[model samples]
Target chain A: MGKVAREVVEKAGINVDELVKKLVRAAGAEFTTYYYYTILRANAIGFDGEGIKEIIEDMRIEDRNHFEALVPRIYELGGELHRDIKDFCKDAACPDAYLPSNPRDVKALLQVLIEAERCAIRVYADICALTAGKDPRTYELSAAIMNEEIEHEAWCSEFLGEGPSGHFRRGAPGESPYVSRFLVVPKPGV
Target chain B: MERRWVTIADSSELAADGVKGFSVGDKRIVVVRYRGRYYAFDAACPHMAGPLDEGTIVEGRLECPWHHYLYDLESGENYYPKNVYPDDLKHTVAPLRKYPIRETEGKLWVALEDAKA
Candidate 1:
């Protein structure tokens, strides 16, 4: 742990340890969501499933990107991910987005996806609200991830034909316009 | 230990349809007022410990802000899953713990040990 890095947030009157716990849990949610989405993406098939499958794939990779982005900040704040993989899943901040019993029912599948994204939006919004102005880096990172989550919700809502979400689909697979910069991995084709 | 009365908040802090959070001896308790009655329950969500102080009371249920898991303010039972969730998931969402609360002398008092299931 960098003494100076840790003290900055502590001196700001924030409980660094609590904040780190929140970050770690948020990261755990992203990591687990990525895994569940993989199952959803695979089961999303056939005629009706084709369209939503693309969206699911996009969200899957972006959630993975979010996990990749959050880990470094967790360490920077003097926290570490659980060594046990099961513990990581158990520590997820949001409930798992289990695939519906009838994966063939596209509507049910979309509902599960939309609810997961909504939970993610609330999670990041709380973190953003807590760390705003006091911790710039975490705040900025959360805001970026929240942007994608909001878009994901919009996409699922639109696919369900709920109404116009006033957003377009991604230009390419894994087009993480907002959170890509925070990723430690180099951008594709860079 | 026997249950003891603990003063939690001034009456004025909780307006009708309002919620307030108070920490009592390491226990975080949230008080909610609805229909001119007050109810108290554990403030941390049974799901993820999301602060229930940040949650909203909807149709007599306290909705956790993190994932929107709701608990009936009166019964402290997980409210929506019975209708919104599948047959299996309804059994998985845990009910919140509730404490006995009363208002007297312009202050709110809660029974520390007698938590309703």
Candidate 2:
């Protein structure tokens, strides 16, 4: 708990406490999405000959990265993730990305993926709006997370032939191009 | 404990469409005017607590602005999922509890309990 770090945000007229609650909710959404995406990834295999599999894996891992990046900031703002995992998950800011009852339907899977990304985009957009021009650190972090979420949406939307994502697949899986800077602790394979 | 009537919003703050949010204590309440009458309800939407204070009264159903979840304006009974899915899908949502509200002299007041739900 850095006293001055929290002090500065409050002094800027931001409701430091409410901001912390939003961060915790955002983190919970990321953590649960990581868990759910793993199941979706398994279902993705051999679907359209595995092109979707690789993308699902990237999104799954990046969602985990988002969870890792959000925690330190929550603590910096004097907030903590709920002590009970169930409590944390129940309060997640987005609906659970449940595998469709009909997982074999590729469009059903894509719809789930796209909607989850859309919800994440809205969640971070609100955070960014709240912190913009006030809390620089939180603002940067949320803006970065929002970038990745938007790309995730584009990728899923393009896969569904909604349109071109205007982007290509990751150079390496789950590179998290926008959010990587905030991920200070490197994972083993990175 | 008896609840006291608290002034929530000026009648003029509402738009012609009659959708607006006002803060009363720590709670965010949405005040809507439907059919030449006003109504108030807590704004937390199902699942994400979103669609907060940004909903529309469409044909007497309050529609969640983001996901389009619908509820009856007066009774607060959810009218979605149950309408869209199969008869056996058995989708149910927690009813949105309505706050007891009154309009007088161009002002809206709600009787919120000391410890509200």
Candidate 3:
């Protein structure tokens, strides 16, 4: 097993540790969507396009639902829901500042959401695989979370009016160049 | 058996500003030249195996087109900033793996050894 998984098994008691990790991973996934929607809502103001505005608003609520579902699991695992925005930001794989330049654009907003959903799918899959048969409760929780993420991905794809694979092409028009410019280089021969 | 050096492409095809993809012996590789030096690595992103050829080159790193995970060309390290967790979770660290690279005669090469072998 990897060092992180082994350390987690040792420090927090196998059952509780797996539960905590799974919950944190689920919450972390929702946090990314929540952060994106919050920015999108702020950018939607003054835009007279009601359809675009409504879509953004609806997604904001869906993300909130995901966050709410994670609260009880966090408590069950003897861990506090990460309430502080700074803490959430600290744990994010991609920083909030790297958000889209034009959040009012539905295309750009959906792009970010799709990316978040993909990451969530991977994280939840890992959690479910690790906890399967070991902690049935966490296994079930991860399975449910994965289903929700799949729905989110589908919704984003539908909103873009393109097949799921279409978003991988050139970035949205007028989107921030910084998002593409910011590269994460790994260490040598890791 | 016959010795072959398929002309993948000219080195100039990959300028300092961008990255290019090539195939050799069924192995896909990405050639990135940064600061006038060429470096090569697996053409897929480590995060989700996204195509690195479709990604952009920034500074000395190749940014994954999928989730924007960056990999340094020379060292193959993730250039993205590290996540700083709370003191309670400081012990958790997730780092990406890197691959070997070589540049000779203006052509880049990467090792393609099967782990099981």
Candidate 4:
């Protein structure tokens, strides 16, 4: 717990407990999404699925980046992840991004991916709205994550034949354009 | 036992699937209008105390937004992960507390006492 850091947020008249709870859930969502996406990415085979593997990999690793970036801020705000792994997973803010019942149906898979990204966008947007002005550090971090989530949604949506994403590939896949600066561990390749 | 009923809102104010949270003294309560009927329960999820008011109601069950643990709106029974949850673990966590609600004269009221089986 950062004594001074906690004190500053408390003095700002924010409910530290509520804020911490939200942060923990957000982190849990990111972590669990990373795990689930890996499965989805691995199963990305066949005609349409193979074509989109690159995008799935990009989103998968970026979600992991988000989880890494969020932990330090959680501890800084005096929040601790549950010692029990079950508890941590059970508290994830978003629903599980379950693989489609028919894995071979590429459209079904895309639907799942698009919905998960949309949920993430909402989660970060809510955090950003709550922390704006009241807690600058969390606000900035959440805003950064929100930007990535938005881009991720666009990429998945474009694949669904919705509309053009207006985005080219990242300089490299899963570059963590907005959140990499906050990660303590060096990314494998930036 | 005597039941104390408190008026929480007018029936017209709640649309189908609408969820509202209220602070009755120190207790947080959530009321949901589902399938033309209203159900009331403790606002916090048993797992992590997630705000139940923010969760979605589907197929007669309300899901906790945090972990997606589900409870039947009427019976307050754990509807998901019961078969998967360890037997001892199931017994350890608290189940949702449901309060009886009545609609009369265009208003909805909740009894302070737990609903009788």
Q: For candidate 2, give the lDDT of residue A157.
A: 91
lDDT of 1 at A134: 91
Question: Model 1 over residues B1-117: C-alpha lDDT tens digits?
Answer: 688899988989987898889999899998899998999988998887888987877677887765556688878888643333555777878888889899999999999877866
Model 4, B2-56: lDDT tens digits are 8989988888887777888877878888889987888899998876788898877
Clashing pairs in 2: none
After aligning candidate 2 to the native by TM-score, how far in Å is the CA of B70 from where it should be? 8.7
Worst 10 residues of 2 chain B by lDDT: B81-90
Candidate 4, residues A1-190: lDDT per residue as tens digits?
8999989989988888888988998999899889888988988998889999999999998998999999999999999998998888877877667676666777777777876786687677777877888899998999999999999999988998999999889877789889988899986653
Worst 10 residues of 2 chain A by lDDT: A43-52
Deviation in Å, model 2, residue B102 alpha carbon: 13
Tell me which of candidates 2 and 4 scores higher on DockQ.
4
lDDT of 2 by residue, A109-190 (tens): 7877887887788778878988999999999999999999999999999999989999978988889998899997886776
Which one is best on DockQ?
Answer: 1
What's each prediction's clash count? 0, 0, 12, 0
Q: What ordering of candidates by DockQ runs from best to worst?
A: 1, 4, 2, 3
DockQ score for candidate 4: 0.20
Winner on lDDT between 2 and 3 is: 2
Give native contacts recovered, as a fraction, per prediction.
Answer: 0.09, 0.00, 0.00, 0.26
**DockQ of candidate 1 (2 decimals):** 0.30
What is the C-alpha local distance difference test score of each model?
Answer: 0.85, 0.80, 0.55, 0.82
Residue A133 displacement (Å), model 2: 0.8
- Compared with the true structure, model 2 gives a TM-score of 0.75
Residue by residue across A1-190, what tens digits does model 3's lDDT show?
Answer: 2345345444544666545644664565467667666766666555443444554554455555555666565665567656786665445433232245554555555565665665566566766776776655556666766665666567567667766533332133212122112113322352
